[model samples]
Target: MATLPPGPVRLYGPQFEKDPGALYAEIRRQHGPVAPVLLEGEVPAWFVCGYREVHQVTTDSQLFARDTRRWNAWSQVPQDWPLAAYVVHNPSVMFTEGTEHRRRAGAISDALDAVDQFELSTQCERIADQLIDEFAGTGEADLMAQYAERIPLRAAVAMCGMPTADMPGMVRDLGLSIDSSGQESLDAYGRVQQAMARLVADKRVAPGPDVPSRLLQHPSGLTDDEIVLDLLVVMAAAHQPTTYWIGNTIRLMLTDVRFATTLSGGRASVGQALNEVLWQDTPTQNFIGRFATRDTRLGGQRIRTGDLLVLGLAAANNDPHVRKDAGGAVGNRAQMSFGHGEHGCPYPAPELAEVIARTSIEVLLDRLPDLMLAVPAESLTWRPSIWMRGLTSLPVRFTAV
Candidate 1:
């Protein structure tokens, strides 16, 4: 169990970015299910692409743990590594194990569970309507920048009871934290931590009806510091991924005639489009993922203790064996988009995201029934991060009314 040779398909570069789906299929064909992969900086890791292999790795938490400190490639990773903030171990629920993880995660679930779904959807509709009004009279809009990217952050900060005044800055900082690298990325992460810390402190002194307030009052006795960290996790989880889900769903609805022609009234179509995006263009395509606890073999690949395994979530969804058995992607909630097993997206989180995304799309279509792509679908470009699958912009036009 020593360092192996670098992978053939470098998971970066323009070629891979331009056509990642093709590269993923090629990797699967050439390297089998659990193939060797090179992360940024030519770091070696395992990419678990097969549906079954991903299932096994996720299900066996002991064998494949969430802790990143156990990763053996740290020696090879550079200090300036942009992704360092993501994998850095903290006392937050993300890096915790066993009882500790359950305690923290349970508090989160309870807090999220207390949210009234009926009210949440109503709130989402308001957020969506407000966003749409900004561009409704313009006759054309870049939905990604103007519409899709704005909704999730606004709704989430409102739900968390943060000041409306802080939102524009929060949106910018959160974007950098997710998309930036090097010192800039670290700076953005620090700013987010500071902001959440202030929120947690304020909530401790004066509580209210919001996620952070609930965490402050929960019986789990989360520390101010712990609440601060977990709040960052929850917000980051809630924001960018949910944003892309909205954007990707809209892109799907506008471009695909199958969806476009069917929307006399598209509550059902909205749900179908949302689910289908989870299968094809998952917001989080590849995850930083679990570390090997000990020596093991997965999908015939020899894995050393402390080796890193990047979960090829989107790839696994398109796995031929599973897709063949399941017939097709439509109506298949079985996809690993939100992930699976113990440390997955944690119950109420996924449900809330669906509420936000569904309402966002449904409202947009209602307000603009004639919504159609402003440019050829081929001209739409995806953002170039291997970890995220999202359009750079989705231009659309409708009658100004």
Candidate 2:
């Protein structure tokens, strides 16, 4: 077995957040496939960066598990620790394993599958146009805050059958949940949970042809708490990643001359640009806390039972073994952005998510064909997160329509 280095590499520092791709390249050069790293809260974990290794860890559920209850950090850390918020043991499908994982995941998948993709696409287009109309007269807007973020929330509200009146608050809570300070994050998480719980109750009392309602009807027999957490999972899964996806793809379209030329010349579609982003810069750069079920060897390193493993989705996607020509793999679906195996993304399958993102982008681009970045690309900043890779803002200017 390869010996782990003496000290854990800090993976959540400002430097790492500033340029993760460079950091990942250095790590791969120094540590091979699986590198030992420390999260922001000094949490020790292994980052699986090799494409084949990530696939093995993600698919071989028997060797590595998604259940946080198996995480050694839970026993070692205090309940009120800031990191505890992320590792909160919930009955949601995101944290389950084996049969329970399948049952809970199936409920979500069926609910999402029941949605009309055409209606969802139309709704996204309508929302995009409406949002664009808010800034059409101004000629300048922060697309990240004004458009990319809001469209997904609105679409999620419509799909989950939540009240539109609660959208502003939901948006605030969701943003806080992702980027807020310590205590504020906890408070924001509480509000989000309460809001989702209320939606569960409302859906139960008056079921509609929405995802939450369909989940309630699933034969999994999930409890009320389970249903609430699962609903939050759906909302988070649908809104945040999708939001980043739109922003990233739009950034690519606006800044990369290659993509701009292809899109303008009709040689490549918006779907193709979106796929390239998924392969090169996935929305969720890294995902949490898979625990080893037993003492095991992975990627030439020893993994103890309950040790944490973070799948480096972005790094794995860029792994040279799997991707020989990263720039040429346009429209490729082999990227691990949506993940793989039994615990892969269950809501808003890759195709449907792409449709929503593409529709929104198409509506905005068609309405303002002259859109260009207001600031230099290097001036833009990324959200400092261990789980997601998102721009803090994307400012753009376009001719008033």
Candidate 3:
């Protein structure tokens, strides 16, 4: 067997920080499924690149613990700083393990069952139509800023029974929190927390039939603060990534001839097409962090207790081991942008696929058939973050429909 790459590549500075897809791709090429990489500072983490290893690491509760508390004390931040605190150890429904996690997952699943997918499809299509109507006359617009980001925010807000008016600012504040790179931005963090707290209070008093209110009313062993955090978590996870995917999809359709051809021909399922977008251009490039609770071996190296492991879901999705369905490559296809295992994103299968499909039907395929990039494709800007991998702006234009 080929010897596993050394302990872990200590990753730092702007280049590695800027775009890790290249680094991850190289690692996968060099080291197969499991490679060691350091995140933040001296944090030793296993980077799993292959689909099988990623599934094993993510689903294996005994070997790797998703709870952030088990790792470093400094990783924990104050609850007042919800974003950082969440990044460290907020204990939202997704991170919990064993029976408690299972129970919470079951509750969320059951609650979601009541939501009508058809209604969701209609709502998403309606939102897409409204956005297109407003911007259609403008002749040009930042696809990411004006459309992609707005739809998901509106959907998430409506689902949580929050006012749509507050969505723009809330989404902006949340974006700032995720974009925090230098000294932690207390102001941005405060704005997000206050907005969430207000929503929590409003939802508690008026208790609408939305996901947030239901979670609060049901009180599944989670406190008011915890419930609010949970809601914020959902918003954070749902909005930006989907927005990024939308922009990326448009970019691919406009630039890649083959991808555009497939969409134009109507040979691909929108769901499958969105999956291709996710695989080819994942919104979040970084893997969810997990700490080792017990001594274990990965990448042919012994990982001691308290060691952190980073599972590169994006990289694994592209791994040779995980074969894509025979259908699509760039546009009309399959991918692992949603992640895998118990904590993997539950939204992508239906919630996400429906949105992308409806949006495609309303916008790219129908409303703006000749949509093309306003600037050279290479001129587009990308947001800098170790977590989310997306373009900052995707300017485009199309012949009036």
The number of the candidate with the highest TM-score is 1
TM-score of each: 0.94, 0.92, 0.83
After superposition, candidate 1 runs with Cα above 4 Å error: 1-8, 181-188, 325-328
Tell how far residue 284 is off in model 3, in angstroms: 2.3
Q: What's the true lDDT of residue 395 in model 3?
A: 86
Query: Worst lDDT window (10 residues) for model 3?
Result: 76-85
Candidates 1 and 3, the one with greater TM-score: 1
Each model's RMSD to truth, in Å? 3.2, 3.0, 4.4
Best lDDT among the predictions, by candidate number: 1
**Residue pairs whose backbone atoms clash in candidate 1:** none
Could you tell me the lDDT of residue 246 within candidate 2? 94
Q: Write the per-residue lDDT of candidate 2 for residues 281-370, one digit (tens) a residue.
A: 899899885899999999999999999999999999988887777666545687899888888887556667877898988888778878
